[model samples]
Target: MTRHTLSVKSLRTTMADRRAARRSRQSLERQLASYTSESDRIELDAILSRHSGAEANELRSIINRQAMDRLIRTGA
Candidate 1:
């Protein structure tokens, strides 16, 4: 049997786990602008999932959903 001891070193528990990035108001607008077509919209939505844990996500969801509803109703 062999036993070994290592020297003490600085370590961070969170260094390996990546935190989801927080999006700013301007960043959200830029993201919105990137969507031009239905395919683009789907891609944008996939990318959006990363930073949507914040309070603003609900607001944007409500607003965009309403806009989509209006467009469908108007048939335009």
Candidate 2:
């Protein structure tokens, strides 16, 4: 393929990846909202805003685990 064609393909892939990540983040935020208090959600958002890269991923993983635990405990 030509260089221009390759660049366009890479750009498209990057955009798709970003959109998918945004959807996943929104889904997780919605899940947290369903069970968390407003104050707690605000705090969580603050923490997220301060972190990036692996730290953010770890926080999200922890949040997802805790959410799952709550669901299981509540029989929901």
Candidate 3:
């Protein structure tokens, strides 16, 4: 390919990758918005820090369940 064509293709690929990343971040933000409590949000951040591979939805569900379990155990 010509140098000009190669540059154009490279720019297009970079832009597409950036757009995909932005969309992924927006989706994650929406999922995280489900956790309205401060403690749950803090727990989520801790969980995310420790479990880097976990998705927001899955981790949120786990944190919510764990919080519920704690509440039940304490009878509060």
Give me the candidate number with maximum lDDT: 2
Best by TM-score: 3
Regions more than 4 Å wrong, model 2: 37-76
Model 3 is weakest, by summed lDDT over 10 consecutive residues, at 51-60
**Ranking 1 against 2 by TM-score, winner:** 2
TM-score of 3: 0.58
Model 1 alpha-carbon miss at residue 54, Å = 1.8
How well is each residue in 1-56 modelled by candidate 2, as lDDT tens digits?
99999999999999999999989877876676465655785788687988889868
TM per prediction: 0.36, 0.51, 0.58
Q: What is the lDDT of residue 1 in candidate 2?
A: 100
Q: State the local distance difference test value for candidate 1.
A: 0.55
User: What are the Cα lDDT values of the candidates?
Assistant: 0.55, 0.78, 0.74
For all predictions, the C-alpha RMSD in Å is 11.7, 9.2, 10.0
lDDT of 2: 0.78
Per residue, candidate 3 scores C-alpha lDDT tens digits across 1-76 of 9999999999999999999988987776567557757787787678677764547556656556656866788898
